[model samples]
Target: MHGYTQDKDEYAARLRRIEGQVRGLAKMIDNDQYCIDVLTQISATTKALQSVALGLMDDHLKHCVSEALTEGGDTADEKVREASEAIARLVRS
Candidate 1:
């Protein structure tokens, strides 16, 4: 199983909340809300997503990576590389 398996429900709930935030953003645009107001909400939504990403990354390191390292060899190396690439993508976002 993936590292986030234990907290899967929590992640799903958080993603649902973020989904609502996105829907609200679209509604704000449809209703012609203030530019900065929309931007502020956008910033909040972005930060929420980043928070989830960070949590998942932490979980991966604590569980999946830890497990791989215990086994030792190419599997461990690949997991670390995969995690690094994921982190790079998160940072770029």
Candidate 2:
């Protein structure tokens, strides 16, 4: 019922779908699918994973970062900075 609980449920659902996509990709390889075809599926899986990451990052900024800022000063800024660096890494990859 709480906000965090709701966000956690959504994240779990997204991850579950990504897990299934990975398994499907394995099956595709086993079936001797073409290289391009396999690669396309892999790309899709990667995009799905990225989407999940983005969603979680959004939740982190809106909830965690916001709450930290309200309670602490430099410590909260440090957390936000760390989170920004993490997002930058994710975007690069």
Candidate 3:
């Protein structure tokens, strides 16, 4: 199974909450809500997504990368590369 399987439900719940926040954002725009208020909500949503990404990265490193390291071969190298790429993407975002 995947490394995130254990926390899959938590991730799904967070995503659902973020989805609702996005919908609310759309409504605020449609209603011509204050610009600053909308911007604040957008920031909150962005931070929530970042939080989820960090949690997933931690789970990946703790479970998948750790397991690959124990094996000590090409798999370990690939996992390290994969994790590095993931971190790079997160940083770019």
User: For every model in order, what is the number of clashing pairs?
Assistant: 0, 0, 0
Cα lDDT tens digits, model 1, 1-93, are: 999999999999999999999999999999999999999999999999999999999999999999999999999999999999999999899
What C-alpha RMSD separates each model from the true structure? 0.6, 2.2, 0.7
Please write out the lDDT profile of model 2 over residues 1-93, one tens digit for every residue. 322566787788888998998999999999998999999989999999998878777777777888788989887988789788989999799
Higher-TM-score candidate among 1 and 3?
1
Q: List the residue pairs that clash in candidate 1.
A: none
In angstroms, give how far residue 23 of model 2 lies from its true place: 0.7
Model 2 stretches with alpha carbons more than 4 Å out? 1-4
- Report the poorest 10 consecutive residues by lDDT, candidate 1: 84-93
Can you rank all candidates by TM-score, best first? 1, 3, 2
Total clashes in model 3, counting residue pairs 3 or more apart in sequence or in different chains: 0
Once fitted onto the true fold, the runs of candidate 1 whose alpha carbons sit more than 4 angstroms away are none
Please tell me which model should have the higher TM-score, number 2 or number 3.
3
C-alpha lDDT of residue 58 in model 2: 78
Candidate 3 lDDT over residue span 9-51, tens digit each: 9999999999999999999999999999999999999999999
